[model samples]
Target: MKHKYAESDGTTRHVWDVERIWKLAEDLEPFEIHIEEIRGLDSVTWFYNGDEPTVRSVSRHAGRILNADTSLPPILTEDFRVFDGMHRIARHLMEGTSRILVKKFSTNPEPDLIEKL
Candidate 1:
Protein backbone atom coordinates (compact mmCIF):
# COMPACT_ATOMS: atom_id res chain seq x y z
CA MET A 1 0.00 0.00 0.00
CA LYS A 2 1.13 3.58 -0.63
CA HIS A 3 1.48 5.97 2.30
CA LYS A 4 2.59 9.59 2.31
CA TYR A 5 4.15 11.79 4.95
CA ALA A 6 4.82 15.48 4.75
CA GLU A 7 8.28 16.55 5.80
CA SER A 8 10.16 19.83 6.04
CA ASP A 9 11.73 19.30 2.63
CA GLY A 10 8.78 17.86 0.78
CA THR A 11 6.30 15.03 0.79
CA THR A 12 7.76 11.54 1.06
CA ARG A 13 5.84 8.75 -0.59
CA HIS A 14 6.25 5.39 1.12
CA VAL A 15 5.38 2.21 -0.65
CA TRP A 16 4.76 -0.56 1.85
CA ASP A 17 4.32 -4.25 1.33
CA VAL A 18 0.91 -4.63 2.91
CA GLU A 19 0.87 -8.40 2.75
CA ARG A 20 4.17 -8.64 4.57
CA ILE A 21 3.09 -6.19 7.22
CA TRP A 22 -0.12 -8.09 7.71
CA LYS A 23 1.74 -11.35 8.09
CA LEU A 24 3.94 -9.79 10.74
CA ALA A 25 1.00 -8.54 12.81
CA GLU A 26 -1.99 -10.72 12.01
CA ASP A 27 -1.30 -13.33 14.64
CA LEU A 28 -0.88 -10.76 17.35
CA GLU A 29 -3.93 -9.91 19.44
CA PRO A 30 -5.80 -6.73 18.64
CA PHE A 31 -6.47 -4.11 21.28
CA GLU A 32 -8.76 -1.16 21.74
CA ILE A 33 -7.42 2.39 21.83
CA HIS A 34 -9.16 5.64 22.52
CA ILE A 35 -9.61 7.59 19.31
CA GLU A 36 -7.89 10.61 20.83
CA GLU A 37 -4.80 8.54 21.52
CA ILE A 38 -3.93 8.24 17.86
CA ARG A 39 -1.78 11.19 16.85
CA GLY A 40 -2.39 10.68 13.15
CA LEU A 41 -5.96 11.82 13.72
CA ASP A 42 -4.67 15.33 14.19
CA SER A 43 -2.75 15.45 10.93
CA VAL A 44 -5.18 13.92 8.47
CA THR A 45 -5.14 15.90 5.27
CA TRP A 46 -6.36 13.70 2.43
CA PHE A 47 -4.83 16.00 -0.11
CA TYR A 48 -1.13 15.27 -0.51
CA ASN A 49 -0.45 18.13 -2.90
CA GLY A 50 -0.76 20.77 -0.14
CA ASP A 51 -3.71 22.30 -1.88
CA GLU A 52 -7.34 22.58 -0.89
CA PRO A 53 -9.31 19.45 -1.66
CA THR A 54 -11.37 19.53 -4.82
CA VAL A 55 -15.00 18.42 -4.94
CA ARG A 56 -14.08 15.12 -6.51
CA SER A 57 -11.44 14.36 -3.89
CA VAL A 58 -13.77 15.31 -1.05
CA SER A 59 -16.51 13.13 -2.48
CA ARG A 60 -14.15 10.20 -2.87
CA HIS A 61 -12.93 10.42 0.69
CA ALA A 62 -16.46 10.88 1.99
CA GLY A 63 -17.55 7.73 0.22
CA ARG A 64 -14.58 5.84 1.63
CA ILE A 65 -15.19 7.08 5.15
CA LEU A 66 -18.83 6.19 4.97
CA ASN A 67 -18.27 2.78 3.50
CA ALA A 68 -15.38 1.78 5.75
CA ASP A 69 -15.92 -1.39 7.74
CA THR A 70 -15.47 -0.65 11.41
CA SER A 71 -15.43 -4.33 12.25
CA LEU A 72 -11.91 -4.58 10.87
CA PRO A 73 -9.24 -3.17 13.10
CA PRO A 74 -6.80 -0.59 11.87
CA ILE A 75 -3.09 -1.37 11.70
CA LEU A 76 -0.60 0.85 13.46
CA THR A 77 3.10 1.17 14.11
CA GLU A 78 4.70 0.82 17.52
CA ASP A 79 4.51 4.56 18.07
CA PHE A 80 0.92 4.61 16.76
CA ARG A 81 1.35 5.98 13.28
CA VAL A 82 -1.42 4.50 11.18
CA PHE A 83 -0.33 1.81 8.75
CA ASP A 84 -3.87 1.37 7.48
CA GLY A 85 -7.53 2.11 8.14
CA MET A 86 -7.60 5.86 8.62
CA HIS A 87 -10.91 5.84 6.79
CA ARG A 88 -12.35 3.41 9.31
CA ILE A 89 -11.14 5.58 12.10
CA ALA A 90 -12.87 8.52 10.51
CA ARG A 91 -16.03 6.50 10.31
CA HIS A 92 -15.85 5.66 13.98
CA LEU A 93 -15.24 9.28 14.89
CA MET A 94 -18.23 10.33 12.85
CA GLU A 95 -20.31 7.78 14.72
CA GLY A 96 -19.14 9.21 18.07
CA THR A 97 -17.28 6.09 19.01
CA SER A 98 -14.68 6.76 21.65
CA ARG A 99 -12.41 3.77 21.01
CA ILE A 100 -11.59 1.42 18.18
CA LEU A 101 -9.74 -1.83 17.66
CA VAL A 102 -6.20 -1.85 16.26
CA LYS A 103 -3.39 -4.24 15.45
CA LYS A 104 0.08 -2.89 16.04
CA PHE A 105 3.55 -3.97 15.02
CA SER A 106 6.02 -4.55 17.83
CA THR A 107 8.63 -2.78 15.75
CA ASN A 108 8.37 -0.47 12.80
CA PRO A 109 8.97 -1.92 9.36
CA GLU A 110 10.94 -0.14 6.68
CA PRO A 111 8.96 0.82 3.62
CA ASP A 112 9.67 -1.04 0.41
CA LEU A 113 10.30 2.24 -1.37
CA ILE A 114 10.69 5.80 -0.14
CA GLU A 115 10.55 8.64 -2.61
CA LYS A 116 11.27 12.15 -1.43
CA LEU A 117 9.56 14.70 -3.62
Candidate 2:
Protein backbone atom coordinates (compact mmCIF):
# COMPACT_ATOMS: atom_id res chain seq x y z
CA MET A 1 0.00 0.00 0.00
CA LYS A 2 1.29 3.45 -0.90
CA HIS A 3 0.90 6.44 1.39
CA LYS A 4 1.35 10.05 0.38
CA TYR A 5 2.14 13.04 2.56
CA ALA A 6 2.42 16.58 1.32
CA GLU A 7 4.89 19.01 2.79
CA SER A 8 3.62 22.09 4.56
CA ASP A 9 4.81 24.18 1.60
CA GLY A 10 2.46 22.17 -0.63
CA THR A 11 5.29 22.00 -3.14
CA THR A 12 6.54 18.57 -2.31
CA ARG A 13 5.04 15.16 -1.62
CA HIS A 14 6.32 12.11 0.22
CA VAL A 15 5.42 8.55 -0.63
CA TRP A 16 6.01 5.45 1.42
CA ASP A 17 4.70 1.97 1.91
CA VAL A 18 1.99 1.43 4.49
CA GLU A 19 3.89 -1.38 6.14
CA ARG A 20 7.01 0.74 6.46
CA ILE A 21 4.98 3.59 7.87
CA TRP A 22 3.31 1.42 10.48
CA LYS A 23 6.65 -0.17 11.28
CA LEU A 24 8.09 3.24 12.06
CA ALA A 25 5.13 4.00 14.29
CA GLU A 26 5.66 0.72 16.08
CA ASP A 27 9.32 1.53 16.66
CA LEU A 28 8.46 4.69 18.52
CA GLU A 29 8.30 4.12 22.24
CA PRO A 30 5.35 5.45 24.20
CA PHE A 31 6.68 8.48 26.02
CA GLU A 32 5.35 9.37 29.43
CA ILE A 33 2.34 11.71 29.48
CA HIS A 34 3.10 14.01 32.41
CA ILE A 35 1.03 17.06 31.50
CA GLU A 36 -2.31 17.08 33.26
CA GLU A 37 -4.24 19.45 31.04
CA ILE A 38 -6.54 18.12 28.30
CA ARG A 39 -6.07 20.23 25.20
CA GLY A 40 -8.64 20.69 22.45
CA LEU A 41 -7.94 20.47 18.71
CA ASP A 42 -7.45 24.21 18.57
CA SER A 43 -4.39 23.89 20.77
CA VAL A 44 -2.45 22.52 17.80
CA THR A 45 -3.69 24.83 15.09
CA TRP A 46 -0.14 25.37 13.98
CA PHE A 47 -0.19 21.96 12.37
CA TYR A 48 -2.90 22.95 9.91
CA ASN A 49 -2.16 26.67 9.78
CA GLY A 50 -1.30 26.44 6.11
CA ASP A 51 -1.94 23.64 3.60
CA GLU A 52 -0.10 21.25 5.84
CA PRO A 53 -3.00 18.87 6.31
CA THR A 54 -5.09 18.44 3.19
CA VAL A 55 -8.53 16.81 3.21
CA ARG A 56 -7.14 13.50 1.99
CA SER A 57 -4.68 13.43 4.82
CA VAL A 58 -7.35 14.05 7.42
CA SER A 59 -9.68 11.43 5.97
CA ARG A 60 -6.94 8.86 5.80
CA HIS A 61 -6.02 9.43 9.42
CA ALA A 62 -9.61 9.56 10.51
CA GLY A 63 -9.99 6.01 9.28
CA ARG A 64 -6.97 4.91 11.28
CA ILE A 65 -8.23 6.62 14.41
CA LEU A 66 -11.74 5.26 13.95
CA ASN A 67 -10.28 1.80 13.81
CA ALA A 68 -9.30 0.47 17.24
CA ASP A 69 -6.48 -1.70 15.96
CA THR A 70 -3.54 0.66 16.25
CA SER A 71 -2.43 1.46 19.78
CA LEU A 72 -0.21 4.35 18.70
CA PRO A 73 -0.43 7.30 21.09
CA PRO A 74 -0.15 10.94 20.21
CA ILE A 75 3.18 12.75 20.71
CA LEU A 76 3.58 16.41 21.55
CA THR A 77 6.30 18.93 22.17
CA GLU A 78 6.92 20.55 25.53
CA ASP A 79 4.71 23.51 24.66
CA PHE A 80 1.93 21.05 23.69
CA ARG A 81 2.45 21.22 19.95
CA VAL A 82 1.55 18.03 18.15
CA PHE A 83 3.97 16.51 15.63
CA ASP A 84 2.82 12.92 15.33
CA GLY A 85 -0.63 11.39 15.42
CA MET A 86 -2.23 14.22 13.47
CA HIS A 87 -4.68 11.68 12.05
CA ARG A 88 -5.88 10.72 15.50
CA ILE A 89 -6.21 14.40 16.25
CA ALA A 90 -8.27 14.91 13.11
CA ARG A 91 -10.47 12.02 14.13
CA HIS A 92 -11.01 13.61 17.53
CA LEU A 93 -11.99 16.87 15.90
CA MET A 94 -14.36 15.14 13.49
CA GLU A 95 -16.02 13.12 16.26
CA GLY A 96 -16.23 16.18 18.53
CA THR A 97 -13.96 14.45 21.01
CA SER A 98 -12.12 17.25 22.75
CA ARG A 99 -9.51 15.35 24.72
CA ILE A 100 -6.50 13.33 23.54
CA LEU A 101 -3.61 11.50 25.14
CA VAL A 102 -0.19 12.83 24.19
CA LYS A 103 3.37 12.38 25.42
CA LYS A 104 5.24 15.65 25.52
CA PHE A 105 8.89 15.94 24.58
CA SER A 106 10.97 18.82 25.89
CA THR A 107 12.41 19.45 22.47
CA ASN A 108 13.17 17.74 19.17
CA PRO A 109 16.00 15.93 20.83
CA GLU A 110 19.29 15.15 19.17
CA PRO A 111 21.19 11.90 19.67
CA ASP A 112 23.46 13.52 22.25
CA LEU A 113 20.57 14.80 24.32
CA ILE A 114 18.81 11.48 24.14
CA GLU A 115 21.96 9.67 25.22
CA LYS A 116 22.63 12.04 28.10
CA LEU A 117 19.19 11.61 29.53
Candidate 3:
Protein backbone atom coordinates (compact mmCIF):
# COMPACT_ATOMS: atom_id res chain seq x y z
CA MET A 1 0.00 0.00 0.00
CA LYS A 2 1.09 3.53 -0.71
CA HIS A 3 1.53 5.93 2.16
CA LYS A 4 0.68 9.54 1.43
CA TYR A 5 2.59 11.29 4.20
CA ALA A 6 1.55 14.90 4.42
CA GLU A 7 2.54 17.25 7.21
CA SER A 8 0.18 19.53 9.11
CA ASP A 9 -1.02 22.55 7.17
CA GLY A 10 0.13 26.05 8.11
CA THR A 11 3.06 24.50 9.99
CA THR A 12 6.68 25.40 10.35
CA ARG A 13 9.09 25.25 7.42
CA HIS A 14 11.15 22.13 6.69
CA VAL A 15 14.85 21.82 5.95
CA TRP A 16 16.45 19.43 3.40
CA ASP A 17 20.10 19.78 4.26
CA VAL A 18 21.63 16.67 5.85
CA GLU A 19 25.02 18.18 6.66
CA ARG A 20 24.07 19.68 10.01
CA ILE A 21 20.91 17.69 10.63
CA TRP A 22 21.06 17.34 14.41
CA LYS A 23 18.45 14.62 14.22
CA LEU A 24 19.91 12.12 11.74
CA ALA A 25 23.19 13.05 10.12
CA GLU A 26 24.50 14.87 13.17
CA ASP A 27 23.39 12.06 15.45
CA LEU A 28 23.16 8.90 13.33
CA GLU A 29 25.48 9.64 10.49
CA PRO A 30 28.58 7.51 9.88
CA PHE A 31 26.27 4.94 11.39
CA GLU A 32 27.01 1.23 11.53
CA ILE A 33 25.17 -1.91 12.60
CA HIS A 34 25.36 -5.68 12.10
CA ILE A 35 22.53 -6.64 9.75
CA GLU A 36 23.44 -10.22 8.88
CA GLU A 37 23.60 -11.47 12.47
CA ILE A 38 21.35 -8.96 14.22
CA ARG A 39 18.54 -11.26 15.37
CA GLY A 40 14.94 -10.38 14.72
CA LEU A 41 12.70 -8.95 17.44
CA ASP A 42 10.64 -12.11 17.79
CA SER A 43 13.63 -14.45 17.44
CA VAL A 44 15.35 -13.26 20.60
CA THR A 45 14.38 -15.30 23.62
CA TRP A 46 16.01 -13.13 26.27
CA PHE A 47 14.13 -11.50 29.10
CA TYR A 48 13.55 -8.54 26.79
CA ASN A 49 13.11 -8.57 23.03
CA GLY A 50 10.55 -8.28 20.21
CA ASP A 51 8.69 -5.08 19.27
CA GLU A 52 9.16 -3.87 22.83
CA PRO A 53 12.71 -2.73 21.93
CA THR A 54 15.08 -4.63 24.21
CA VAL A 55 18.12 -2.49 23.61
CA ARG A 56 18.63 -0.22 26.59
CA SER A 57 20.77 2.48 24.96
CA VAL A 58 18.44 2.97 21.98
CA SER A 59 17.16 6.41 22.92
CA ARG A 60 19.32 8.22 20.37
CA HIS A 61 18.97 5.39 17.89
CA ALA A 62 15.19 5.32 18.03
CA GLY A 63 14.95 9.10 17.99
CA ARG A 64 16.43 8.93 14.52
CA ILE A 65 13.63 6.61 13.34
CA LEU A 66 10.73 8.43 14.98
CA ASN A 67 11.74 11.87 13.70
CA ALA A 68 12.87 10.69 10.27
CA ASP A 69 10.99 11.68 7.06
CA THR A 70 13.41 10.98 4.22
CA SER A 71 14.19 8.06 1.93
CA LEU A 72 16.72 5.92 3.76
CA PRO A 73 19.18 3.28 2.71
CA PRO A 74 17.54 -0.02 1.72
CA ILE A 75 17.26 -1.46 5.23
CA LEU A 76 20.79 -2.67 5.96
CA THR A 77 19.74 -4.68 8.95
CA GLU A 78 17.88 -7.98 8.52
CA ASP A 79 14.49 -6.31 8.92
CA PHE A 80 14.89 -2.61 9.53
CA ARG A 81 16.73 -3.13 12.82
CA VAL A 82 18.80 0.03 12.44
CA PHE A 83 17.44 2.75 10.19
CA ASP A 84 20.17 4.88 8.57
CA GLY A 85 19.24 8.03 6.69
CA MET A 86 15.71 7.70 7.99
CA HIS A 87 15.33 11.26 9.21
CA ARG A 88 15.37 12.61 5.67
CA ILE A 89 12.72 10.05 4.65
CA ALA A 90 10.43 11.13 7.46
CA ARG A 91 10.81 14.79 6.62
CA HIS A 92 10.20 14.14 2.94
CA LEU A 93 7.03 12.23 3.66
CA MET A 94 5.64 15.03 5.77
CA GLU A 95 6.62 17.64 3.19
CA GLY A 96 5.35 15.63 0.18
CA THR A 97 8.78 15.51 -1.43
CA SER A 98 9.27 12.94 -4.18
CA ARG A 99 11.99 10.28 -4.24
CA ILE A 100 14.80 9.59 -1.77
CA LEU A 101 18.32 8.17 -2.15
CA VAL A 102 19.16 4.97 -0.33
CA LYS A 103 22.38 2.95 -0.10
CA LYS A 104 22.40 -0.78 0.30
CA PHE A 105 25.26 -2.17 2.37
CA SER A 106 26.79 -5.63 2.57
CA THR A 107 27.56 -7.74 5.59
CA ASN A 108 30.73 -5.72 6.08
CA PRO A 109 29.86 -2.42 4.53
CA GLU A 110 32.51 -0.46 2.70
CA PRO A 111 33.15 2.93 4.26
CA ASP A 112 33.89 4.36 0.84
CA LEU A 113 30.61 3.16 -0.66
CA ILE A 114 28.12 6.01 -0.64
CA GLU A 115 25.19 6.93 -2.89
CA LYS A 116 23.77 10.38 -3.70
CA LEU A 117 22.06 10.56 -0.32
Best by TM-score: 1
The regions of model 2 sitting more than 4 angstroms off are: 1-65, 68-71, 111-117
lDDT (C-alpha, whole model) for all candidates: 0.78, 0.48, 0.36
lDDT of 2 by residue, 42-116 (tens): 544434637466788766655666873224566554456454565665655556654555555554332111111
Residues 5-111, model 3: lDDT tens digits:
11113443222222222233323333433333332323422224244544664555456556774435433322343223444444444565554444333342212
Give the better candidate number (1 or 2) by TM-score.
1
Report the lDDT tens digits of candidate 1 across residue range 1-117. 444332232577666676667777778799988988876687845765576688988989999999999998988877787777889999999999998889988877776777776
As for TM-score, the candidate ahead, 2 or 3, is: 2
Q: Give RMSD (Å) of candidate 1 vs. truth.
A: 3.0
Query: TM-score of each candidate?
Result: 0.80, 0.40, 0.26
